[model samples]
Target: MTVCAYLALGSNMGDRAEQLRQAIHKLNRRDGIRVIRISPVYETEPVGFVDQEAFLNMVIAVESDLAPEKLLETALAVEQELGRVRTVRWGPRTIDIDLLLYGDKMLQLEHLTIPHPSMTERAFVLVPLRDVWEGGALPVLNRPVDEYLRLLPQENKGVQKWGTIGWETGFDHSES
Candidate 1:
């Protein structure tokens, strides 16, 4: 059975756009995963480890036959392939692929969490999430995601729309 899942992708190192594009294509090429839709890219200020370059962030919707844990593994594999070095908390990365939601499944595991805990708190996440999700509400949040977005303080409001990604022409990795 196929499950609909949401993934948040962000890159702060190398060619950020290309990194994100590459990650998306890699995920799309995986056997059990098919990229469904992508949110517009956003330029966001660095979060916890704030001394690094700003990040390009966005979300993607996917139809996947992989279970949630395996899906998270795939995402981590993509990050490793992209040369992501996890040295600091919320630090810079070549690419970061976070599994935001997996169908309506609520999961709590040592290495993964669904409805990614920080989704609503960060505008970088909510802005693009609102773009891809059909409605303003999310499965886990009782109130609309917009409500959380509005309450985020200005210090954390460093998110702004950048542009959309093209899936067919430039970054095609269909046969990979």
Candidate 2:
């Protein structure tokens, strides 16, 4: 079985851009997983924990044979590999990988949730996510990316496309 998964990547500690790249690389390298499309990296002001440096964030689209639970475990492993520390909620981190959507499947387990609970509310997640889906639509929300972005609170956090990372840098996600 193939699942169209959406993941949101963000980093606020160390080389933020590099951390994001590493997280994605690790995801791609996992068995039974392939990255389909990656949105351009975007820089945004920190949300919630207001006094930290801005974060470099992006969304990745992947097709995987792994089940949702296994995928969540894979994401956590990648976070650990990238030096992520969970000292505080919404705290600084070397990397953060959130499974935003799982093939239109709604999940609620002890440690994971599909169609990520807060995705619609976060501008950082929504903008880049829309970029990855070829048609710029969110399958889980059934809403256009443009519309979802507009509904976010009126904050001036800006997001812009940075570039791509090399395959050898971290994990590998093959593109078809």
Candidate 3:
């Protein structure tokens, strides 16, 4: 059975948009994963460690047969393949892939947490999340993604709509 999973993508190093594009392609290319709906990119100021470059962020919903852990592995693999170096938490990155939701399942493991800890507080995550979340109420939140978005003024965080990466049909492999 295929389950829908939502993942957030961000980049602030190298070709930020290109990194996001490649990550989406790689995720879709993985077995048991299909790229479904993708949200427009949002440019936001860096959170936590605030000394980095601004980030271009977006969200994507995928249909996956892989378990949550396996899905996370796939995401990590994409990040690694994209030259993501994890030297600092919330620091500048070539690419960042975060699994925000897995169907309606809730998980709290050592390394992975479903509903992604503190996602609701981050506008960079929630702005794009509102774009792709279609369910009546956000699984466990009991409110729509937009409602959560409204609660927090993403504008205060410098979150704004950026670009709509045109990759619906397929990626132009010649360019990265």
Candidate 4:
């Protein structure tokens, strides 16, 4: 069965924008996964660990036949291939791929969670997500993502559009 899923991508280490683009490219190349649309990239301040560099963030809508766990494994492998090292919680990284939603299926497993637990509270996640979000209520929130976006506190103004991904010349990843 094919399922539509939203994945949030972020990077704060070593050519952040290029890292994100490469990650997206790798995801699209994966079997049974096709990237439908990508949100405008956003630059945001680090949340949990403020001692790091700013992060480049974006969301991608994908259609995949891979099950949730398989999809998660794909994401993890992509991250590892991109040089992601998990040293700290919410720490800086070369790339971060989060499975935000998986076609209305709510799940809680040891290695994965659908609709990412902290997504609703983070503007970095919600803002870019709102960009690619099609018309429908988020499965876990049970309300439109925009509604949840509005309910969040306004203090986190860190999320702002960086630019369109493929159109931007600064994201040339071929040399790396």
Question: Which candidate, 1 or 4, would have the higher TM-score against the true structure?
Answer: 1
Residue runs of model 4 more than 4 Å from their true location after superposition: 167-176
User: For residues 6-97, could you state the per-residue lDDT of candidate 4 as single tens digits?
Assistant: 99999999999899888988988888888888899999999878999999999998899999999999999999999999999989999999
How many residue pairs clash in all the candidates, one count each?
0, 2, 0, 0
How many residue pairs clash in model 1? Answer: 0
Model 3: per-residue Cα lDDT over 14-112, one tens digit each: 989999988988887788888888999999889889898899999999999999999999999989999999999899999999999999899999999
The prediction achieving the highest TM-score against the true structure is 1
RMSD of each: 2.0, 3.2, 2.8, 3.6
TM-score of each: 0.93, 0.89, 0.92, 0.91
* Per-residue lDDT of 24 in model 4: 86
All candidates' lDDT scores? Answer: 0.88, 0.81, 0.87, 0.87
In order of TM-score, best first, we have 1, 3, 4, 2
lDDT of 1: 0.88
List the candidate 3 regions with Cα displacement exceeding 4 Å: 153-157, 169-176
Give candidate 2's error at residue 69 in angstroms: 1.0
Judge candidate 3 against the unseen true structure and give its global Cα lDDT, from 0 to 1. Answer: 0.87
lDDT, candidate 2, 91-166, per-residue tens: 8989998999988798888888787888888888887887777765677567897887887768743676666655
Worst 10 residues of 1 by lDDT: 167-176
